[model samples]
Every structure is written in structure tokens, then in C-alpha cells.
Target: MKLNSIISERWSPVAFSKKVPDDDTIQLLFRAASRAPSSFNAQPWKFIYGIKDVDTMYGYLFDLINDSNQKWVKTAPMLALGIVETVPPGRTSLNRFAWYDTGMSVGNLLAQATDMGLYVHQMGGYDHEKARKVLNLSNVHEPAAMIAIGYKGDPDQLPREIAERENKRQGRKSVSEFVTKNPF
Candidate 1:
């Protein structure tokens, strides 16, 4: 069976080129993400991004990453922090689906990036509190994940262990494994 090109083409890579995406391209990515649907149109997703050489923001985001991710993520041309506003605007109650909605936004961003010949790798291995502190964020905003974005690079240039993994073909579980008829 065939799948959508954007869906099939998207893959997270530990190796990334040092060439930064242009401002227009980055804006396009954010535009796509902004179009994602949200509960009650809350649009709780937020992104903090930085391009290498544009400012010191990249280093600030990089510092929040764990040592392991830092090993390969340094070469990425752009970095972003995904966050969710747990509290809806002008409301006190928590939005239980905030994180889920944020993930959908990221999905939109990733699809747009893939269509544009860019690659994105989202990592959960980061210091969440550090990111919050670095960004000077309030409690209402919760860090979701860190994203490394750039063109794909030579996996051979990666560290031995990472290179080994990058060289292997990726596999996913069959739909049958996760789908069910009706029973919970």
C-alpha cells in the first residue's frame, strides 16, 4: 500500500546539516503549525525557535538539552522548544487536552517541513525546568519537547553508536497491533 509522500518521507535523523533555513521558510513552518485544530479553538500550542547565528537564543535552547542529545544536535541549523498553555486564555481551569493539541500542531509543522525538503527531530531528552527558566516562562506554559530542524546530513559523521542506528532501516508496528474493533 502507498502512503502520503509527506508521511512516508518524514523521518527523524540525528545528523543534520549546518545550513540554516531562511526566514521565509521558517515562517511557513510556523504558519502550518498555526493552522492545526485545537479544542474549542484554544490554540494552546506555542513555539520558541532560534536559528544558528541569528542570535544567542539557540544556545539558550541547546543548554536545556541533555548531554546525550547535545552530542548530535549541535550540528542542527535550527532549534525550537514546543510548549503548551495548560490554562486557556482568560480562564483558570486547566485544559486537559493541551498537550495533545500541542502535539497535533507539531505534527503539522513536521509535515510542512518534510514537504519543504527539511527534516525535523523532536526529542524528549531535555531539562524541562531549565527550558522554562531560560525562556522566563510562567507556570501556565509547560515545555513539551525540543525540536532539531535542518537538512539531513551524512550519518557517517555521527558518533559511532548514533551512526550505527542511523544506518539501519526504520520499522513501525503494524496497524493491527494498535487498532481494535470496538472493545476497549
Candidate 2:
């Protein structure tokens, strides 16, 4: 079976164009994410975003990213931090699925981006503790990932090794390799 073009074509590229998506477009991305299902409809995901040359938060988010990622991320036009609300409002117990739910939301965001001819790269190599301190993340909130968003850029502009890596096709495990029948 063939996969949908959007899904098949989706990839995380380190080389991003300088073009900045408009405010409406950015908001639309979040709207798509908002449509994702969540535990008890708690909608635990929260995103903090900033556009390059337009918002100071962009720099702060960029600074939080590790040096290696920073090299190519600098070309992206926007950056965002994905955060999850660990506890539901008025509740003390932990929401075990908060992280998973947040990831679902981000998945929706990525699909929307691909449909709109944009690219998104989610990064785990960021200063998590510093992010908590700098962003003033509350006790109930925890950082999940940092995202770089923009159009695809010229690979030639990236460092040689990174450019090569960016040009490589993304590979995934076959369904049969990970799937199992009931009563396994």
C-alpha cells in the first residue's frame, strides 16, 4: 500500500528558508493541533512560539537549544517550545498521559505544516532546566520539545555534513516489523 504524499514526504530538515510564515498561517497550525484528541478532553498541550526578527522569545528559545542544532536552526524563521500540563486543573494527581497527549498534538501540527508546504523539526537537545527557569514554567507544566518551523532552504548553504544528512531520505520501520496480532 502507498502512503499519503503528505505523510510520505514529511521530513525534518535542518536547512530552513528565511521566509517567515504569516501570523494567520502560524495560528492555523495551532488550530490543527488543537483538534487532536486528549485525555478527558484536558487538552494538556501548550505551545510558546516566536518569529525570528519579530519576537524576543525566539532568541530565548534559540539560546536554549544545544549548539549542534543551533547551527542549522538559526536559519528557520520561527521557534517554539512544546509544553505539557502535568496536572489537570483543580487536581493533584499526575496525568500519566500528558506527555503522550502533547506528542499527539505535535503530530497534528506537523501534518498541518506539511499540507501547507512548510517544514517542522522537533528537537530534544535543549536545555530543559534552563527552559523551565527562563520560561517560568509552573510546577504543573513541563517542557516536552523545542520546534523549528519554516520553509525548506538551499542545502548548499548548510554545513557539508549537515547538508548531506538533510538530503538523505528518511527511513522508517515496516509495519510488520513493529505490529503484532492480538493474543500475542
Candidate 3:
């Protein structure tokens, strides 16, 4: 897909078909993530996908979700937890760049999903501490975020609150408000 098309056409999808991603498809998504840029190549990301135990994953997230998000996420088939090691590097502080790098991977993954005709919804409205316990996750690979992926579906079937959001056209902040000509 062209850069502009991908940027403009892609949107987070909350309504997913019940179809779960096969191992090969999930691996392809991970492979796309692997190509994402990382700080100094420390490459701190480690991902965990929930397929067979999707219920557990959903329960885990359902418990952790920021109340605002739970209403919509009730239906996705696959959930990917983004993790990153935060140990300090030589003479430097903790790997602050881990999440940043992982976020890049998420961008790549989402874009790839878009290319593959799948849909993804990236979320931060989740409880990190509980996520650690349910997934047997550790602070080592800090659970930065979770993403839901699956086939797109009719938004009307979603919970009313999220269904409203799904119908609205997504937009970005004005470049004029965010871009700069030089160092601030």
C-alpha cells in the first residue's frame, strides 16, 4: 500500500469477526514487528500472543481495561501483549526506549495487518499489574500495551457506546498544531 493510503485508510477496528488468526498469520505479524526500529538496536521487545487461551486473555484484559474501553473490546479474537525489558544499559538509565521501540513495532504490525486485510485496535486502557499476574508476565518485559486483531465486523452489534465511536470517522490532530520548523 502507498504511504498516504495506509496512513489515511487505516483505522483501529473494534468489531472483529470471531475468526482467530492462525499460527502462520500470527507469525507473519510478529515478523513485521521484528522489522520495527529499536533504540540502539537493543531490541527490547518480547511479545506474547493469546490464541488457544483467548478466554483467559480476554478475562485478563477485561479485568484490567480502563472502564471506557471494556465496552468495545468484548469481541476481538486475538490479543497481543507488548512487552519490553527495562534493565539499565552501560552508564545509562533504564531502557526508556523499550516502549518507544515496541510502539514502533506496534505501528508496523498494525500497518501490516491493514495490508493483510485484517483489522487491529491498539489499546492502553488496561491494568498492567493484573496483566502481569494473569499472563504470568513480569515487569522485566514491562507490559506496555495490548492490541486486538481480527476480521472487521458491523459496528452496530457492538455495545452502544463503542458502536457510536465506530461510526464516527477517525481523524488526526492538525499538523499545524503539532509540526515545527525547528527545535522548540
Candidate 4:
């Protein structure tokens, strides 16, 4: 089946190069994410990112990752946390679709990064409360996911098990399994 180059080419790589992406490229990613549609245009997504060569940000974020993820994610040149505001500014009720909107924003970010020859690996394996404290996030914000972004690196550099998985081609469920034309 045919697919758009940006969509087809995007894959989450466990190994990443050490080269930090420039500030302009990073901002471009946020710009793409900002364009995603949201419930009532609330745009609840927010990101906290750190480049490897920068200050202590990378280390602090890295430490919050679970042990399994920490093994490989440290090699990534950039790290970010996706956050969603449970209650949007100037609103009284909870934003029911906040997490869904945040995921859409991340989708845009992934596509944009792929178009720029970068790869992104997003993980749910992190300490949420720890992230909240470290980032000084208010009670209104929820930690959604952690993202490791950088250029793809040599799979051989990864640990044996991870390398094997990374080198293998991934598969997806057939469309028939998930798509439906009428109510079941």
C-alpha cells in the first residue's frame, strides 16, 4: 500500500545520535504541534524539552525515565515531556479530551521531525509525579508522555536485545481488523 513519505518513513528508533538539534529546528517542531486541532481549540498540549549539551535539563529529565527506558534513551540528543492541561485557561469545566488532543499534537511533532530527517521515540515509562515536581508543573497539568528526539543511530550500539528488536522490521494489524463500515 502507498503512504505519504512523512508517515511511511516515521519510526521510533531506540538508538539516537549524540548531535543536538539546533534551536530553530526544535522550535519548528513545536510550531507544527501548535497547528494540530483540539477540542474547542483549547490546545491543551505543552512541552518541556532539553537538549543534551545544554544545562542540567537533560539529566534531570532522563532520571525520571524508568530503568528499562533509561538504558537506551540517554543516548538521545534531546528529550521532552508532553503535558496536557486538564483545565484550560479561562475555563471552568474539565477538558475531557485533553489527553487525546495532546496525542494529536505529538503526532504532528513526529511527522514534522521525520520530514526534517530526525526520529522520535515516545515512552510512557516514566515517573509522572517526579516529572511534575521537577518541571514545577501545577496541579492542572498532567504528564502525558516522554519523548526522545534525535537522528537515528547505529542499532549495533544498542544493547543486544534492544538492538535485535530495533533492527527488525515492525508490523501493524491489517486494516480489516480495526476498520468498520457499520455498527458491529
Residues 1-184 of candidate 2 have per-residue lDDT tens digits of 8989988889999899889999889999999999999989889999999999999999999999999999889899999999999999999999999999999999999999999999999999999999999999999999999999999999889889888888688778998988988656
Ordered from best to worst lDDT, the candidate numbers read 2, 1, 4, 3
| Cα TM-score per model | 0.96, 0.96, 0.85, 0.95
Let me know the TM-score candidate 4 reaches against the reference structure. 0.95
Residue 53 of model 4, lDDT score: 71
- Residue 15, candidate 1: alpha-carbon lDDT: 89
Q: What tens-digit string does per-residue lDDT give for candidate 4 at 1-184?
A: 7899999888888888777888899999999999999999999999988888785888888999999999889789999999999998987889999999999999999999999999999999999999999899998999999999999888778889987768666899999999999898
- In model 2, the runs with Cα more than 4 Å from the true position are 182-184
In angstroms, the error of model 3 at 140 is 3.0
C-alpha lDDT of candidate 4 relative to the true structure = 0.91
Query: Where is model 4 more than 4 Å wrong at Cα?
Result: none
Q: Report each candidate's C-alpha RMSD, comma-separated, in the order given.
A: 1.1, 1.1, 2.7, 1.3
What local lDDT does model 1 show for residue 126?
97
lDDT per model, in order?
0.92, 0.94, 0.77, 0.91
- Which candidate gets the maximum TM-score versus the true structure? 2
Q: Model 2 misses residue 177 by how many Å?
A: 1.8
lDDT per residue for candidate 3 within 37-147, as digits (tens), equals 888888778777665354555565556777777676767778777887786434346887887888898888887888888888888888888778877865465788778
**Least accurate stretch of 10 residues (summed lDDT) in model 3?**
51-60
